[model samples]
Target: MKVLPIFLLLFYMALDGLHAKELPSNGNDEVIFPITELQIYADERGFVNFSDVLNGEVEFVISEDFQPKDYSVDSYYWIRFPLHLNNIESKQWLIEFYDQTIDVIEAYIPTLDGSYKKITMGDHYPFYQKSFDHKNFEIQIDPKLHGEIVYYFRVKSHTYADIRIAVRSINRFIEYSLFEYFLYGLFYGMIFIIILYNLLMFIAIREVKYLYYTFYIFSVGLYATCVDGIAYQYLWPNSPQWNQIAHGVFLFSLIFWAMVFGHRFLNVKNSAPRLHKAIWAVIFARVLLFIYAIVFDNSLFEYRNIEILPLSLIFYTGVYVLVRGYRPARFFVMAYGLLFLGFLIKALLNISVIPFSIVSYYSLHICFLMEMLFLSYALSDRVRILKSNRDRAMQRIILQHKENVKLKDKVNRELERLVDKRTTEIQEKNIMLEEANQKLNQQTAEISKINSILDLDNWKLKNNIKEILQDRLINKNLTLEEFNKIFPDEVSCFRFLDRLKWENGYSCSKCANTKYNDGQQKYSRRCTRCGYDESVTSNTVFHKIKFPIEKAFYILYLTNNRQNKYTLDELSEMLSLRRNTVWNFKKKIEQAFSDKEDSHLIITDLFSYHINKKVS
Candidate 1:
């Protein structure tokens, strides 16, 4: 609809008085008109081409509204302003464009002979291409060479560009340029000074908050340079593409550091932890938007108003913390308050709510300076409050120490009197206690010697029984009860698998990592390198078998025999399992180890050798 484009145009109408000048329709012999201020009047000629204007097919609506046209990348704006060069004798005249960030400007200068001279100028071109080596585009006018002429300028930019143009004499332009550059020097110099001071403070105190503020201030200065075209003129004159997105990049940096610094300085993590988390979320969103602007659509960077969210959030946090009686946030609140006022003033100027002036136009820059100063004060003020509290704490500790010393002296006097009386009795009791301890030690030594002999016998019995049970498992067909002696339950079977699977060494199948710790599950090793959790039964013939592992071991022991000792129905009865399920697993065991006749491989060998085969 018409609403969207109209809104963009209105929002981006940066400044007034860009242009429209036309030739007085006088004959070629002599063309002149009376003028006092030497300013050209223009009309907004929308979407018309140079050919149409040259052929006299277009009618110009001469009005004061014909200022520097707000830029929309989709449409071209032509300013048709008439120039009346009357009584031109010696004073030199030139057209100067105030907005240096216009992407393109096609200026058509007319001559007395009904012909025009075309000159191309814009920030899109190299800085050296401009006739004047200044931030604003300027074209010298030869007034004596032509009588009457109309000037047409085609203005377009990627973002909002101030379209204000002023016709100044050569001397006047020089004076204005010098004064402007001087102010720029002061502005940027102050920013540089602030950055240096904060850097030193960061080093001296080792507080990261100062460092964050320094970066934020640096970003603000860089964004200001991008906005005023000083960066394009001086820093990267040869790189026109960088000039287009410089403002956007620095603006994002400014907001990013502002959020971080505000979060730290306000101690949001301690005071408002929920909002502290919200700050990180907003920061993540801003990063995503910035990346999308850079990679997918750079024009999205022109949506500078999106910054209002973070700025308002920071301002609200400052106010909220201040309301909660945070002393340091007072100055922080004031700083952002004035900064928002600057944004508001600039917005008002864009909407024509406020009259245009240098201060109003440069409101943001002025506010940035004030905000930096107040924030620095806030940092120092926070330190002051902390130091004051620490000193009070030290004073309290000293008073408490004196009281503790007096009590210690009184207690020491009473203790000395009590110790004298008990000393002789304590010595006599200690002598008696030593004699009893000696006798007790002699009895304890004899008892310990007897106990060690019994422990040795107990260990020998347990080892021999284990060896016998293991031998019985290999030699004879194990009944379910006998199998329980070797693989008593699922846990015993799992331990056998755990030891049998990694008898050589552990290695991860996924990453080939050879190191591991215990996993969350029992009998499972977690690989240290790849974090792969491998269970004991993984990749084994018994994997996913529904019955208990001890039953499976019993079935395997029966199957490992030259003939299966137990019939499928017998195993179903003994293990309380289905006949078909027992038969299926008996066949799997047979296929895994049926290579040799009367093979007597131990139950542990079955797990290691046939481990690669999985249950289908």
Candidate 2:
């Protein structure tokens, strides 16, 4: 049995020595493996001792897929590989885990004496706790292995288990770090410029929408930095704990501000109330995720699960609003479409739905650059449109002003012609009025002579005759005998009054009917249409007079003849009536004539003649 064991050990040693001569390398500067060739064992309970892996007690399975793909599991993973250094002259080599977000990593390298050299490095621990002082999880392999030496890695994470390992020479890693940082700096510099420009726009325009976009851009830039591992190397090198959670925090912030930007830019609340509510729902989910990140120390695993929900909802609602005919959404849709494509590519890669490549790794930043430039163009386009509208409005106002000026000039010309025509008419009327005044003076002189030749009673009777002539007795100077001939009785006097009142034919006061019947009273009439009784004097000054019609007409004639020219006592003495009775009769006639001067030509001309006579 001892000879068999010794022969087996010698056979294994010779086979391992032959395998060591074919150590993978390309020109010896660095060896870039397409995939990590390792035997992996998953410890589902997460409590498997490292001794079990070293003692060969645990069963190991070879990984078929070496490409970086997400593995969501609660188990700890053990990865074993062999480092053959016999073919390479230099023994100094660096083993680096490319992914920055992995929580805990433990490396176990076999020593010549069959013991293991262990090193712990991951984002979960402080920078001082790492095996190497580098941004990524790096470990410098011991330079003493002469044959095929086995290496082990125990990996665990609260986030995605997406591991990509690389082994490079020290000088090559330094060159790679410088070049990678340069590219990262260039990317961030572009983002910073966009942020600064938009911030200035926000200040200049004082629009909350621009401010929201600025914050969105800033959060996206920072999140991209975190995702690319630049933030861990430079921004927070010492705080590995912060570096671990930075991705989740910045991602949540990016989505939060993106929703805010959409809300203001789209005016969704006013334009689409239902869609606005959906946006709020997405925002609420983002808030809950943000709270989960802050409150739960190890919430990164949960955050990664629903990381795309907020942006997906925002994109969906944005397209809906655009389809609803919001004009401002035109450019927004184009710009966000590119951004969403970038996000889709990255998210697909993150979930292992797509393979990793240069396109998948840097496509988001490229799309970010495109989005920023496009959005800037969109803003400039909006400004151009606003300026065009303002200029058009100004042109319309100027045109309106010119039209008003032309209209005013035309009105002025017409007014000048009208003024000239009116002036000529006034001059002709003045000449006619002067000639009429001379004739009136001559008539007054004749009337004075006639008055002087007559006695006081005849003069008074003549004045009463003048009043009657000036009334319905047009153009006729009549004596008392002639008046008696025309209005010989009370029935004739009342009939004359009725004819004067209804010269246009009788009409009902209420119904406005033309036909009427003879009423009971002498001056009364009844509407045939409505059977309503109406007296000629019903709405006149003699409406309820107890005096006889002839006497009432006489009294009115005396009152009209006297007017303001004589006192009530003088008129009463002339008419042989009481002072109170004459005064009351005078008031009734004056009241009847009030406001009727335009329609009643008899009273209007009589009053005008009296006024002219007094003025002359």
Candidate 3:
């Protein structure tokens, strides 16, 4: 029980030693102190008033360790630093937080009237709202160090709470900022050169890869500027909200364009399909984190936590490219390695894992510059490789074209030889075809002569039959040629028909009257006794015949002589009449001879009643 009490006393003593921190007291006009030497207490609810801390109601514990603080917490952190000055006169002092992204900073300083004068400064407020017109958060302290001088800082942030506090003389602040800005100027100059160079390349080549890389470089450069206080100082001095989220916006943009550059630079889609898909997944993750940051404006640190997985995957993408024999990734890996080292050292320094120093503080900038230089070299090398590949492709095309020309020449020669052979064979076949055609024509002419002789013999046989069977008037059996010569026209045929029908005089069929006068119609006659009218064809087999009279006479002559039994087609052709007219006239002639049935009437006998009658 006595041993446990001794251990408890020792533990309490150790705790006291850890919480005690004292500033150096010297009669100096200017001095600087880091945040490590301060006492800190986190006010979870921020309900503790300054009066409570001053009235011993709340105790201030020492800050975590003698290093920088770089972690995010929801609670408000109250940092107390004890200042000891041995001067009786009032001296100028400054307390500044080097990190620019802190959201709110409240400083409680003890005044001569035994009360605290509060000063607020942060990027969350406008740059002009800061107590001093400086890029970083700072408060001026002019105090007489007689009894006790303590400064309380209430710090809050949406991102990493990098509690990098610096107490300095006013003059020291000016000198430090000048040096810092100078380094920033150099860093930005290099980035500008790279951006301009690549932009020109993009314009000259019109390559999408160069364009993507140009934007990636611009985003990275903008992100670096935002991380530093230069953007807040100069770019948008009045825009506190933009200053607050600028880091997240540029960071997400950098991530997106960097992945796009990687995908194009590595030719991943064509070379490594699976890796290309993984790159897209990383890009999607970046977008989600960006969206989350926008939704929860105060949860940027939480968004960063989600971003780690994709960032790690992006690193692994470089490794995958290297393993897959991607040539560009050699430089890619080197550049990323340097960048990773710089960011790691800076992170370690911010978290107090490594002591804060000038080199460690600007490690990210140094690494970024080196990375940009190496990447520019890599892009140049990529252009060289592409040009070389293009030249080789052109050479291959030219060689293939030459071979095609040779093959085409060989094919043309073979086609010419084949054409000559085909021509000779065609000529021989044409000569043999000509001989066969001549023999066929000779046989055709001989058959034509034999056909003509057979037709003449048939005609002579028809005449012989006509002489033996028909009347003597048509017994001469005029051929179609002789009939056409004797009665070549309609008038001659009409005269012949009149002589055949009314050889003695005109007659009327209605009353068997012999005497007739001229009727109104040219071929009609009117009877003087009975007033009956008659025409040359009105009462004969030719009655009501609308065809030419010459064709009727030839049909009668052919029928009387029995030279030929004409079908409608044959009669129409022989008499030059329509088939229907010939059929009708033949029907009327056959009907006229119907009373003499079974008595084969000759053409003259069939119409003798009309021809021989004289009613006078």
Over the full model, what C-alpha lDDT does candidate 1 score relative to the true structure?
A: 0.76
Which of 2 and 3 is the better model by lDDT? 2
The best candidate by lDDT is 1
Give lDDT: candidate 1, residue 297: 93
| Candidate 3 clash figure, as a count | 0
Residue pair clashes in candidate 3 = none
For 1-616, candidate 3 gives per-residue lDDT tens digits of 0112344434433444544333334644344455555567777787986656554567765544544353445778777766554455444667778778888988886565545677778888888878777777887766554433556778887666667666666666787778877877888888888888888988997988778978888888888878887888888988998777777788778767777887787777887788788889778766776777788654563343343455456567787878977777778777767766776676566566887677887787788888888888888877777789899999999999999999999999999999999999999999999999999999999999999999999888766655443343334455667566656787655665666677666556788777778877665688898877777777667767777777777676665555455677977886677888877776666676676664345445633332223110
Model 3 spans with C-alpha error above 4 angstroms: 1-32, 63-72, 86-92, 112-114, 143-148, 296-301, 340-360, 389-616
Better of 1 and 3 by lDDT: 1
Could you tell me which residue pairs clash in candidate 2? none
Best by TM-score: 2
Candidate 2 TM-score versus the reference: 0.64
TM-score of each: 0.60, 0.64, 0.57
Model 2 residue runs over 4 Å out of place are 1-28, 34-36, 65-72, 86-92, 110-114, 131-133, 296-301, 305-307, 417-616
Q: Report the C-alpha lDDT of model 1 over 1-616, residue by residue, as the tens digit.
A: 0112333322322211243243322322222221221233222435566776544565544334422233245655566555555554456778877778788898887544445678899989999999998998988877665433456777776556566657666777788789999999999999999999999999998999999999999999999999888998889999998888889899999999999999999999999998999899999999999998999998888777778789889899999999999999999999988887887787677656786677998999899989988998899899899999999999999999999999999999999989987998899999999999999999999999999999999888766665655455446565667456556678867877887789889999899899899998788999998899888888877888887888888787777654446667877998898899888998887776666444346564554332222111
Residue 363 displacement in candidate 1 (angstroms): 0.9
RMSD of each candidate relative to the true structure: 13.5, 17.8, 23.8
